[model samples]
Target: MTANTSKSTEGAHEPGGFGALRRLHLSYAGEVQGVGFRWASKLTAERVGCTGWVRNEPDGTVTQELQGTPDQIATYFGAFSRVFAAHPIEYVIAEKSDISPIEDERLFTVRF
Candidate 1:
């Protein structure tokens, strides 16, 4: 995982700190690659002030883990869903895991 610095967005919710961080590891399937998904996700995470990582999986799914406050994290996921809906790129199958908090994360970026 890498650290990125981003300015908070207007009305953007953020977690307090490591203790407040909530984690969500998701598997995104269905035409998830080669469509700037990671880039778009970076923007999404930044908007909601989530700290974690999102990367492409070998199984053609976009994998991401996010840590943040409950509200902020949920807002992030909601925006993410809305983005996919508006973009309408192929299929946007996805599965999410439990939420957990993580420390030492600063910004969101596309992981290699």
Candidate 2:
């Protein structure tokens, strides 16, 4: 299945004029485990100046929360697509939704 590329404009309002900052919870499926997906996510997040955590879920999917400006998040996904293309990693974004951004988040990490 192809990855979801739809962008959600929901939850664009933040109390403190941080409307451009978006946080998304995403679940990826299809060959997402044991294929360096988490590592690539961490690297991509850092490269794009996004703060989030990625982890392998028990249900054979990868879950991630990414926080950044919408542009940064889009850049992160673009980079991931490039990397995955080069490495031939296949995945579908099974789920995606906007969530509250963490205050003072500074890094992206791989969660165990």
Candidate 3:
């Protein structure tokens, strides 16, 4: 008897679960630097099984690129929002750009 793997593998190999992958480019302004924002973002992405990178800008902004399914991406934002809301520092979204998803991304990382 041969074990069929096709049914068990459906949507698991796809980027977003339904073959619809999305990329989110976000820029946050305000008290973002030196507040463990990048660390929080990294953890959130990892927890949601998303792939991408995040970095701090010279102008006191945090930029992130996340790629995954709509649900995964939404979860990532929800996590980040909770982190930011917990801090006393003021936070605001400066920019938000959705781009074409990259097919080769495999893991989330913090960019230096």
- lDDT of prediction 3: 0.75
At residue 46, what lDDT does model 1 achieve?
Answer: 92
Residue-pair clash count for candidate 1: 4
* Candidate 3 per-residue C-alpha lDDT over 34-58 given as tens digits, one digit per residue, 9 for 90 to 100: 9898898889999998999999988
Q: Please count the clashing residue pairs in each candidate, in the order shown.
A: 4, 0, 0
Those runs of model 3 whose alpha carbons end farther than 4 Å from true positions after fitting are 1-19, 84-86
lDDT by residue (44-79, candidate 2, tens digit) is 999989998999989999999999986788799888
Q: Itemize residue pairs with steric clashes in candidate 1.
A: 4-107, 21-101, 22-68, 23-100
- Model 3 scores worst on lDDT over the 10 consecutive residues at 1-10
What C-alpha root-mean-square deviation, in Å, does candidate 2 show against the real structure? Answer: 2.8
Error of 3 at 52 (Å): 0.7
- Residues 21-101 of candidate 1 have per-residue lDDT tens digits of 566666677777898888878899899888788899887888887777777876886887677675677654356555434
Better of 2 and 3 by TM-score: 2
Judging by lDDT, tell me the better candidate of 2 and 3: 2
Best by lDDT: 2
